[model samples]
Target chain A: MIQKILYNFKKYKFLLQQLVSRDFKVKYKRSVLGILWSLLYPILMMAVLAIVFTNVFKFSTPGVNYLVYLIIGLVIFNYFSEASNLAMSSIVSNFSLINKVYMPKYVFPLSKCLFVGINFLLTLIPLYVVIIVSGTELNIYHLLLPYVFICLFMFTLGMGLLLATISVFLRDMFYIYGIIQTMWLYLTPVMYDISMIPENFQTLFKLNPLYQFINFARSIILYKNIPTIGQWAGCGVSAVVVLIFGIYIFRKKQDKFIYYV
Target chain B: MKKETMIKINDVSMRFNLGIEKEFSLKQWFVNIFNPRKFKKEKQEFWALKNINFEIKTGEVIGFIGSNGAGKSTLLKIVAGVMKPTKGSIETYGNICPMIELGAGFDMQLTARENIYLNGAILGYSKDLLDSKFDEIIAFSELEEFLDVPVQNFSSGMIARLAFSIATIVDPEILIVDEILAVGDIAFQAKSEAKMMEMITGGTTVLYVSHSLEAIKKLCSKVVWLEKGNIKEIGNTKDICDKYENYTIKHMAGNYDI
Candidate 1:
């Protein structure tokens, strides 16, 4: 299994490049703005939401500017949304490749994690520049950015593999994910700060692992605070559990996948 | 001294249902779901392969010649481990480069050059092997000018040439090919056949499937003829193909081409 994993990782690198390149090409191939839309879309949305929510509704996350708050949330949430959304069809979309190789099936979702990981990093560069302009003076400990990325990386991987596996047996998974992702964006406090919720509502948000992840991320970027031991524990456990379950399902159902395809 | 048996298929059987029900009722889909694979496709259980037993010595080339639905492809799939058998054992000493379906793994969306690399890896060609043979594969396929274009735009002959070229790499101990030569024009077919002969001569065990009796007689030293999931005969290529052809003609006349 290890050799298979290693070999597939090597092979999947080339295909992953194809997938990301193809994705970028197809998305911007006809659009007038081209790759500029990658930066323009999110930043534009951030500007609009920052203006409207802060001035109009008077909404603000505790001790964090609305833009910083929104960027943190949007960055993390984009990873999940893009990862799962792409993952839902990753196996079926790469049917031509998957059916041919005798490699670990988890590579499909892992590759999605990689391509979206690149997108996530691209979005972050402009975000960091804004942080510099805002003069937040966050912390030297902001060097922990890499560690936080690692946490989010595993989280995306776990969810990607899980969704990819489920989408195989159930064709309705994509449609279901479509509705769920919309609700998920609102339910997780991406646009609004978690502190905006009523005191009684805090525990409900804690149930969402992604909610905890974003809180930790926002703390690092905005508050110059590293996540507490418990925060890390909760997110870590959730990530591991998803990975274990994802791999288990992937292995059990992999051979039979050809029949479904 | 114990001779090493490179490929072994012992009592392997593959069964498929015609998907017709005995009662011919609307609710059979639901009922069949409950029973699942236990129930045959039709009321009748049709065996694509049954009690198939064969052993190919190391470096031996065997041609499988049979009429349509003769279980030749089924046996190859079992040998290649592409599909599992109903109730039997199949084991191989080393890797199998399975071309059970000629264009099974080819992606039309990819360019010929890119598809060559992707298809090469899938067919068991290592990166090193592909790099060394890359130019040769392109030249042999004669897809040079159009190498960068997506294969979907390419003609059927181009697809077959690409698939066959990719499958030949990696020096797999066992090479399982279906009726891939039916593609392309006469010149290309001759080239492919010559390449296949080279592979056989180079000690790559070949399990070739073809409807061309002449090719079988010329190429294969040993032959296995299948009929309705059973091995009707196994011997020299010409003798078994003759028996197979005579049997096929007789069955066709009796059934009124049904």
Candidate 2:
């Protein structure tokens, strides 16, 4: 099964590229600022959150720049949230193609991943600039950023596929997903400090995949420290487990998707 | 000389659940799982196609004639490998290019030029191949001026023309077309018909479904007349089409005044 997917990947690589590219193009279409909004949107949100948290709420990060800290979490959280949202609609939105063509079903959800991944990668540019301008130190540990990205990507892909499949049968999945996403955002320490959580409860918070990824990412970019091997393993394991389960369910249910959609 | 079988369908059936109210969330599903009686009255199973069996030899131009809701599209979708049959199976040799719906894979926000690549990839054409055929597809569609404009701006007829051009660019071994030629302008329709004839003459097996009886008679060698999800008649085109015309006329005699 894996081999067949890889073979189809090679054969349909261009289709995937075009599908992902179309998403990026349509997202910025007719906007005056165009692709700049992908960067600026997160920066603006971070600024608002930074002010509200640091001044209004009296929250502060002693060593790390609060703006940088909030923005990293926003970018990562935004990608996962946006990617899953798109994936939920991916199958139904392309019902015309599904009704006519014989391409692999996973391509639809996977393309959503690629679309969000591109935006995530592009958003990193502004994050990098902020890190440099703020006098944050860069070290070899920053190379481990890609590993964190892979974890988040896999988790998103799996979650997206699962949602995409369910959404085909039940169109309300997206609305339900929207509420879950809002809940998930608050649960993750996107704007708040993780250390503020009681020490014993921190382990429960650490179990959130986004928490693991964001912590590992901030450790590299802001703290100039490599994540402990346990953190790396936690992210990798979470990604693999979610991805395998997603693919399994998606492949199992995809044929029925034609009728349900 | 004997022709080899290109497509084989054996006892294929498609069943759809009709009345089970869809649950939007796990909470609803869990609640309904205990009390399934709410939707029990509406619980119905409809067979879209029933025990369908057919075989097409290589180089055969077969036409599927059926009224709306007669499962013609369902059968073609099964042949295209997009939908799985509830019962039985189908086996086919060679790559299938299904123009089941014009511009099925097109992105409205992308230019016609960009859509060529997008649609071509959905049809399983490699990027390099699409690149090589890009100019040919554009020229055939006659949308040179609008190549840079997003397809959302194109008229439905223009989209159909573009779709037809891209689909016909390659000489597919098997082509499944379903009522697609009806959408474009008459001139492009005639031109696309000519291109289809050219493909047929080139020995490509074509499975076409259209409401136009004239087209079916002109193009098909063998015709399968389906009614209510079952094959009513399968024979030479002239014989079945004549029967179908007479049947419809006789059946609708007093229902409508001409």
lDDT of 2: 0.86
**lDDT for A38 (candidate 1):** 81
Candidate 1 backbone collisions, by pair: B17-B41, B19-B41
lDDT of 2 by residue, B105-134 (tens): 788888998889888888889888888999
Q: Estimate each model's TM-score.
A: 0.84, 0.93
Q: After superposition, how far is residue B251 of candidate 1 from its true place, in Å?
A: 0.8
For candidate 2, the chain B TM-score comes to 0.90
What is candidate 2's DockQ?
Answer: 0.66
Which whole-number lDDT from 0 to 100 does residue B156 have in model 1? 89
**Candidate 2 RMSD computed on C-alpha atoms after optimal superposition onto the true structure:** 2.5
Error of 1 at B63 (Å): 2.3
The per-candidate TM-score of the B chain, in the order shown, comes to 0.81, 0.90
Q: Per-residue CA lDDT of candidate 1, range B68-174, in tens?
A: 88888667766776566778898899778776656655666767887786666555556677889998888888888998888889988889988777776557777
| Local lDDT at B92 for model 1 | 90
Superposed Cα deviation of residue B45, candidate 1 (Å): 8.0
